[model samples]
Target: MRREIIDYLKFLMGAPFIKGYRLIGETHLHIQYYSEFEEFKSDHPMSEYTKEEFDQYFNENDTLKKLLVGESVRLLRQFSYLECVTIEIKSYDRVVVEVHSSRFILNKYFGFNIEDLSLGDNTWKSMFVDVYLADPAKRNELYEKIVCKFNQ
Candidate 1:
């Protein structure tokens, strides 16, 4: 399962953004854009909105709509390179995703049923999303890879 997890994360090589969704105790974390929307690019005007207008603009804007909740802002393109992703198999199980262009570090601990690889909890899912979104390249390779793994 650990090897599977590492293999699963390899698709993060050039992801553009990551989004997370949680319902009750169930959570999902996956790459945003899914690589299918790479041809479309929308620029969001961050400086144009006031606090109230920001919400209104976000509601009406297509670009903002694509972003996950609380991710209304964008990351600079300079932070696209992936430094390394490390999995630590020890007394306790964990994984660390490190980014080369940003200070963001994602640490996830093992949850129930590693064989499933969902690893959904309050913190880990969001962290996974965070790391996924740090890169500005979009490709659904990660999603395809994971789905294929599960299918096997």
Candidate 2:
């Protein structure tokens, strides 16, 4: 998943000014992106997925559904049900306009019961998945920067 995320990020950072993006640590998840584009910089706004929205993410797609035959979504959804959106959206960022984020963390396999999650207290694991998080305005600003960087 990490490799896939990086590959996708690299593919999206096709802007010319972007020298490249590198990994950063200390925080839960971090990546440093270098850009020759004059507008590029370290400051960019990032976003987060609310608790309810995160729950919906898992409810829509359940891993157990993979066990079904033919792999059709209909067949998968017939039996399996999502108690909660197990994936906790810790953070997300947008790399370039239209493209995905630079870094974020999502936690999967949350909750206690398969049918329903623990309402009061549930444990979750932090998953450093692919993607970035940024507000639309920030994303546009970043996108413009990427375009400028690439165009130069």
Best by TM-score: 2
How well does model 2 score by local distance difference test?
0.23
Query: Residues 40-142, candidate 1, lDDT per residue (tens digit)?
Result: 1222233342445333322333323223221211121112222222111111111112111111321122122212223355332344334343333321222
Clashing pairs in 1: 16-137, 17-133, 18-133
**After superposition, candidate 1 runs with Cα above 4 Å error:** 1-11, 17-24, 37-40, 43-152
Off by over 4 Å in 2: 13-16, 24-29, 33-152
Tens-digit per-residue lDDT, 1-152, candidate 2: 24543454443222222233333332121223322122232222132323343233222222211111111111112213211111111112323212222111101221122223122333111110111112344323333322211111
- Best candidate per lDDT, number? 1
Q: Candidate 1, 96: how far from true, in Å?
A: 28
RMSD versus native structure for model 1: 17.7
